[model samples]
Target: MSDTVVIRRSGQAGPTSEVVDISIPSDQVFERLVRDGAVAVARWLGFSEERLADMQLAVSEAVNNAIEHGNKNDAHSRVGVRFIVRNDRLAVQVVDQGTGLAASQLTEGRPSIQNKLDNGEESPRGLGIYLIEQLVDDVELQSDEQGHSFIMWFNLTTQGKEGVDEHHD
Candidate 1:
C-alpha cells in the first residue's frame, strides 16, 4: 500500500481547529512521514522548540511501536497517524492494525532498564511506551478488535505562543 494524507479544517473565517490524517504502508521508512506531519501541526500550534523536540521523539516512538509491534512490518498492512490541532493544544493518534494490547498491559509498571541488563537482554528496547508518556503532556491508549490507538496531547502554553504569529487558518 501507498501513503495517503488528508487535511481537514473547521470553523469559519479563521478556523478554530485543524485535522491532519496520514496513512502509510507498514514500513519503517514511512514512519518519518507520520512523525513529521504531527510535528508540523505542533509547530503551527506554537509549541516551544523543546516541546517540538519532545513531540518528535514521542511521535517517532509511537509510530515505531505501530509499525514493529502492531503491523509486524507487513508492507501490506497500514499504520495511521492523525493530528488534531486546536488553539490551546494538539492531539495526536497513531493507529495500527494488530490484534491490540491487553488492558492489563496498559497499567503495567514502567519497564526497568536495569532489569533488562540483569536478565541478559540484548538491548533495552522495550521502553517506547514509557518514553512516550514522559515526553507528552498527556497520553492514553485505546484498543479494540480493529487495533490499538496511541493518543497523545501536547498543550500550548502562553510562553510557547509569545512570539508566534497570531494569524492562522
Candidate 2:
C-alpha cells in the first residue's frame, strides 16, 4: 500500500510530511519483521547506520512490549504501526490491544541512575520505556479501553534528495 511507504520530498513549498501504516498479528515472530521494516524505511531516508541499530532496538522493544505486556502474547491480537515521515524526523506509532500503562510507569524525562536504583522497585519493568525514550527523539503514549499506542520518533535527514511520494487510502 502507498501509505505503507511514503518517501521524502522537496520543493519550493518546502517539505511535506508523509505517513505509512503497518499491521501485524501480535506474535513474537513478527518482531523481526517490524524491526526490519523500520530499518529499511530509515535507511531509505538516509539515517546513519549507527542510528539504525538503536532504532531497531527501540522498535523491537516497543513491539515486544505490545505483544508481551499489552496483548499478553495473544496470537489472535494485532499490533498496528504508523510511520510519519518528515523533513527532519520520523515518527512511529505502535498500537496494541489492551489498556494503557499506569502514569507512574512512565517518566517525563530520562531516569537518572539514582532514580533507576533508588526507586525501590525490584522488577525490571519500565526498562523498555526508558530505552525507547533514550534512543529516540521523542516518545508519546496513549491508550483507551480498545488499546494502547506508543509513538516514538527520531531525527532524520533525507539530505534533500528527490524521492517518490504516493498516497493510499
Candidate 3:
C-alpha cells in the first residue's frame, strides 16, 4: 500500500506559519509523536495551561484511535500526523491505513440500546471522538479508497480571549 503525505502553508493569505508531517509505524512511537507534537504546538502558540492540557488530551486521544483502531496497532502499517499552524488557528490531522467509518455514523449521543446490548462491544470506542469534539472547535473525519483521516482544529484567537480556567467549580 502507498500513501501520499503533504504539508505546506494553507496558501491562502495568512500570518507566519509552520507545518510538521510525520509518518510512523503503529507502535509506542505513534503515541510519543502525538505527545511531542502537542507540546511543540502548545509552546509555539503560547497556549495557556488549561488550553495546553486540553490540546494534549485531544491530540493524544486522536492519535490513540489512529494507532489502535485505524492501524490496529500493527507495527508495519503507518499513521500520518500533520500539524498546520495558521494565522489564528491550529489544525491537526491524523490519518491511518485502515478502512474508516462514514461521517453519518458519528452522532452526538450515547450508544443506542441495540448497540449496548452487544456486551458493550462498541461502547468505549466512541469516547475519544466525543472528547475530541468537546475539546476542539471543530472535528472532521474524511475517508476515501485510500484510508481514513481525522482532523481536529482549534481557534487560538478565541482561546486567547477565554484565557485559562482550571478550576470551574
Candidate 4:
C-alpha cells in the first residue's frame, strides 16, 4: 500500500492542536517516508535541531519495529502512525497488525553487551525500545492479541531560551 496521509487542524491560530495520520504498507522501504512525515510535523512545530534528530531516530525505530517485528515484514499488513501536535508537547502513536508482545518485553531496561555475552545470546540486538525511551520524553507501550501500539511524547515547552534539560517526565 502507498502512503496515506491526513492532516487536520483544530484552529488556525497559534499552537492549536493538530493531527497527522499516516498509514503505509509493511515494507522497510517506506520507513523513511514515515520518519520524514514525523519530522516535517515536528519541524513545523519549532523543534530544535537536536530534538529533531532525536525525534527522527525514535520515530524511525518505532516504525521499523512495527514493520519488521510486528508485521513480520508482510507487505499486506499496514502500519499506522498518528501524530498529535499540541502547544507544549507532541504525542505519537505507531500501531502494527501483528500478534501482541508480552508485558515483559516492554520493560525499561537497556540490554548490555556483557549481559548478552554472559547469557550466551545469539545476537546483541533488541535496542530499539531502549533508544526510544531515552530519546523521547515519555513512552507507553500497549499490546494484545490483536496488535501493538508504541506511544511516545516529546516536550516542547521546556526548550525555550534555557535549552533542553535532562528531564524525561
- RMSD of model 2, in Å? 9.5
Q: Candidate 2: where is the Cα deviation over 4 Å? A: 1-15, 100-102, 108-123, 157-169
Each prediction's whole-model lDDT (CA): 0.74, 0.73, 0.74, 0.79
Clashes of 1: 0
Reference-based lDDT, residue 61, model 1: 90
lDDT of 4 at 109: 79
Q: What is the per-residue lDDT of model 3 for residues 98-140, given as tens digits with 9 covering 90 to 100?
A: 8756475355665355666767765655777777777888888
Among all candidates shown, the one with the greatest TM-score: 4
Backbone Cα, N, C clashes tallied per candidate: 0, 0, 0, 0
Q: List the residue pairs that clash in candidate 1.
A: none
Which residue segments of model 4 deviate by more than 4 Å?
1-14, 115-122, 160-169
Could you give the candidate ranking by TM-score, starting with the highest? 4, 1, 3, 2
Q: What does the lDDT come to for candidate 2?
A: 0.73
Cα lDDT tens digits, model 2, 40-65, are 87777667666776778889989998
Of the two candidates 2 and 3, the one with more favorable TM-score, higher being better, is 3
The alpha-carbon deviation from the true structure for residue 68 of candidate 1, after best TM-score superposition, in angstroms, is: 1.1
As for candidate 3, its clashing pairs are: none
* Most accurate candidate by lDDT: 4
